[model samples]
Target: MATLVAGANAALTAENPGLDHVVVGMGWDTIPSNGPQAELVPFALMCDASGEAVSNDHLVFFNQLVSADASMTFVGDGDQEQIDVQLGLVPAEVTKIIFLAYVDPEFRGQGTFASVRSAHIRVATAENRELVRFNLGTDHLDSVTAMIFGELYRHRDDWKFRALGQGYSTGLAGVAKDFGIAL
Candidate 1:
């Protein structure tokens, strides 16, 4: 599998022809600390060409768990969630799907990336064959409350993936506002 850094792009379809489905997985290690550890939650935002959610129900996470067209859904395993997306089945209006993680504000645990040691996001086939991986460097950003790990976007008739590794201090609400998501 190819390892990518922030801003690197991979053409998943070109790399492996006839690939119709993939599992986007994210996992992290947290620093040991007293009291509660940070509760990190993974989510995906299905957006239009303008990079905003096409609708209020276009978010897929632990709460909603699925997208409107059934193109994206979460498969819980271990302490992380694997996202499954049927590329061809995704609505044409949807041009991008951004994968992100946030320290759940509602959770009683520490709500920041200060407790995260290391993290990674990867794409694999339905059979668990990893295609590409991006190891996010979470070093020194103690105030970060939300992070954008990667994204899958439409390139003409094909789909491509990019590593982001961007962080936010305003928490998930800031991310929601920027992406036009209704909470």
Candidate 2:
């Protein structure tokens, strides 16, 4: 059974029995009349205790599918994107993973989340059991070119997920910069 949660600060632990991995899935529909089709690219940053990316190698996306320690991976493409995390594989130096979606810059000038019929970010198990989900819909400001959907962070010796739902007009680059990525 999955827990439905809301707000940026809401948190939940991945304490389900036999759970060793969590998949962060993002999905969206394109609005036919919204100029050229846009891609909602999903990515994640492995951050340390201070919320800064540990290194460029920790940026997982289409071009870079896996993290340095094999703890994180970006899978799938197009309207549906996913990030897989191995709870036990993450390095102790790392403390958080921020899951986000961005409107490809190539399509940003003409499209935005407003053109998305519906979108959502979900956390689930390897066996396909949903743990939690957050809807990122047209209600968002049209100027938002990127979104920080949620985050998985360490709380004590356990892992927890927080619903972020924050928007960014600077797109993916902005997010990368905010997380301490050089470029």
Candidate 3:
């Protein structure tokens, strides 16, 4: 599959019914800086049809590696943190699984996005055969503090992958508020 740009999306299960499971991976490279570099922590938000996170436990990251239902599991691999999703096992109330990364607030006090570049997200089969990839564009990275790399959402009985290179200049708090998370 060809690489996707910001806002572009592709059908997942619809293309291959057998593709019921996948590993979504996110990766990035940091730009050298004199000041303390920003700490980037990748996480997944399992949201309901309302677009808000179902609960605090629905937020999966390095700290909370897996969902209670055993549907989404975080797998760390070098610079990339992956989430293995069992599509068929996802809760019925969940409509989307969003992939995001934020600047760890404790690191140099609300760090800027300028510290990272060449960020990307990709989807692959459970066996690691990459299906599609999205390279986040590098425009206006200096001010942003958090970013949404991509998302996998439900469409009827199928799932779709979207490249979302959007960010929050207000820091992680902005993301928490928008998603109704208590930080």
Which structure is stronger by lDDT: 2 or 3?
3
| Top model number, lDDT | 1
Query: lDDT per model, in order?
Result: 0.87, 0.77, 0.87
Indicate whether candidate 1 or candidate 2 has the larger TM-score: 1
Clashes of 3: 0
Candidate 1 per-residue lDDT, tens place, 49-116, comes to 88888887888987888888899988857336799998988899999999999998777765688788
Candidate 3 Cα RMSD after full superposition onto the native fold (Å): 1.3
Off by over 4 Å in 1: 76-79
Q: How well does candidate 1 match the true structure in TM-score terms?
A: 0.95
Ranking by lDDT: 1, 3, 2
Superposed model 3: Cα runs more than 4 Å off: none
Of 1 and 2, the candidate ahead on lDDT is 1
Winner of 2 and 3 under TM-score: 3
Residues 1-183 of candidate 3: C-alpha lDDT, one tens digit per residue: 759988899998999778889999899988776676778989888899889998988888877888888899987583378889999999999999999998887876667778787899999988887889999887788888889999999999899999999998877688888888887
Worst 10 residues of 3 by lDDT: 74-83
